[model samples]
Target: MKPIYKRIVLKLSGEALAGEKGLGIDTNTIMRIAKEVKTIQKMGVEIAIVVGGGNFWRGVSAKEMDRTTSDHMGMLGTVMNALALQDALEKLDVITRVQSAIDMKQIAEPYIRRRAIRHLEKKRIVIFAAGTGNPYFSTDTTAALRAAEIEAQVILVGKKGVDGIYDSDPKLNRLAKKFETLNYIDILNLGLKIMDSTATSLCMDNKIPLVVFGIDEPNNIIDVINGKKIGTHVKED
Candidate 1:
């Protein structure tokens, strides 16, 4: 089936890449994700990915370290994840590029809006790493920012465990309600933890639609791009 959006930004957390171990990259898990990505790429979709580095480091969790230093470390972790993902995709014969916000010219191209767009237009998968080239901003915000820059039609978020947005923590409350659809204001007013408020506000202001779905299912990404309703949908309306 044809994809609903010609261009999309895929947001992946580092924990998602770690699989059940939740510590470091899992070779098998990354391979599985890479294969899924290949399936979608073959459908002529322009894909840009924003990956988090929680598996390697989390700036917010560093109580004794300087916030800037910790966040910078987190940024480097994202770069590592990006390289691994690039390798996996290349092994599958998929053309891919890693663009780093904090440039290390030897390994990745510096974050260039036009160049990134060009890569997508050429049917290349672009992985964005380093969390917006600044400290404190989460990768979710990076996804929103890049999607706007690239004029992507949607932001598809593949969550590690939970399937969709909930009224409360589903893990803590089994009876928590799942929202099939939500307006941007609802997310803000209700204080849902789907994405940080900065990220949510950015998407809201730019009128970008977001799909939050569980990445555990093999076809979740494909299904989401195909317009299947398997998760919470957030938009202006």
Candidate 2:
């Protein structure tokens, strides 16, 4: 099937990589994701990833430390996740490059927009780590910012538990309504927390579409790329 999107920014929460343990890297899950990504790579999709650090550290949750320090720690955690993913993808013979928002020359190359785009052009999967290189920003914002920089057609948000965006938390409310498609205004007016307001605003202003889908289902990423409508699509009205 011809892909509807040539390039995509995959937003993966650190918790998604944790599996049942809910903390640290789950090698099996990472490898599984790597294999899934390998399939997409062969489809000729330019893939760029923005991974969260929630599995290791969440800045907002750590009240004892300074917020900036906590956020920096969270960013470092994302770098760890990035390295683990790079290792798994390389094992599958998939060429990968990790670029960090923060300067981490020993591990990842510093994030350079031109270099990142060039990497994607060469069919190398680029994993963007360290949430915007600043505190008070979520990985969701990193995804939005990177997507804009790379000019990705869509952002595929691979969620952990819930399949799609609902009026209420699916895990909390049994009667929550699932939206098939929604505009940015609806997301803001309805107060849906699929992503932070900053990130949502960025996508809205840029007119980039987002697909909120469950990663649990096999081939869901590829399905999204093929425009299968397996999840909630957020776009302009």
Candidate 3:
């Protein structure tokens, strides 16, 4: 099957990497994700990844800690997740590179835009970590920023349980409405939980499309690439 998108930025929440336990790294789950990623790469699609740190730590949720310190810790968590994913992908015989926003030469290469794009051109999956190398930004913003830097065709948001953007929290409100299609302005005005405002605004201003879908099912990443319409699609009106 031909892929609809030639290049994509996959936004994965750290919680999604935690599997059913909802904490830390899940080896089996990471391996499963790696296999799926491998499948998509084989389709001749350039893949770049931005992973969140919600599973290991949340900077905003910790009231006692200094905001910057907490955020830095969160960045570190993302790096750990990045390394884990790198290992999983490498084990699958997929050439992968981990680039950290914050310099960690021993483990990950420091993020360089031209170098990252070069890696993608060579069919290597690049995992971006450390959340923009700043304290206040979320990984969602990182995904948007990286997508723009790499000129990605779209951003594929791989959510855990929820399949699409809803008017309210679907987990809490069973009556929440699911939107199959939406515009970026609607997302910001309606305050949907699809992504942080910064990330949404970035994609909107750049006119990058987004596909939000569940990662629980097999070959979901592949399905999204093939434009199977299994999730909410946000784009310009």
Candidate 4:
């Protein structure tokens, strides 16, 4: 199917790349995600990716440690994931670029809005790294920030545990109501925890659609871009 948006930011959890064991990099999962993104790119959709580092590390995981140090550690983990994704994407014949929020000249380009968009305009997949380059902020917010800055049409969030946004935790409550479609107010009121509040507010303020879906399913990114309606879509009023 044809993609719905000309440009999209695919947000993936670091844990999602860990596969079933939930530790370290999962090659199968990474390859699957790469192929899915490639499918959309083949159909003329410009893809930008923001990968989390929860699998290897997360700032909150080391709550007992100094917040700044822990956050920097988490940011390094994101760079590791970003490099892995860049390798996978390039292997699949997708022209790719990696721009780090924190400068790493040898490894990636520094995050420059115009340069990243230029890469996309030239049909290269841009992978954003380093998670907003700030302590205590999540890669989720990085995705939203980059999406907004790049003027992406939508943020396709591939979740690890849940299929979509629900009033309550679906696992905890079997009868938890899932919304096929939702608005920012629903997320704000329910505190759905789909994306961080910062990320949600960023999208809401910019009118960028956020589609949260299960990443466990193969080709899910392509499925979302293809307009399959496989997950909950959060939008602005």
Count of residue pairs whose backbone atoms collide, per candidate: 0, 0, 0, 0
- Tens digits of per-residue lDDT for model 2 on 108-172? 99999999999999999999999899999999999999999999999999999989999999888
Which runs of model 4 end up more than 4 angstroms from their true locations? none
TM-score of each: 0.99, 0.98, 0.99, 0.97
Ordering by TM-score: 1, 3, 2, 4
RMSD of 1: 0.6
Q: State the displacement of the C-alpha of residue 167, model 3, in Å, after optimal TM-score superposition.
A: 0.8
Residues 1-237 of candidate 1: C-alpha lDDT, one tens digit per residue: 888999999999999999999999998989999999999999999999999999999998999999999999999999999999999999999999999999699999999999999999999999999989998899999999999999999999999889999999999999999999999999999999899999999999999999999998888999998889899999997
Residue 161, model 3: Cα distance from true site in angstroms: 1.4
> For model 1, what is the alpha-carbon lDDT of residue 60?
83
Assess each prediction's global lDDT (C-alpha) against the native: 0.95, 0.93, 0.94, 0.89
Q: Give the poorly placed runs of model 3, Cα more than 4 Å off.
A: none
Please give the TM-score that candidate 1 achieves against the real structure: 0.99
lDDT of 3 at 237: 90
| Candidate 4 local lDDT, 170-218, one digit each (tens) | 9999999988999987788888788788888888888989899999977
Model 3 TM-score relative to the real fold: 0.99
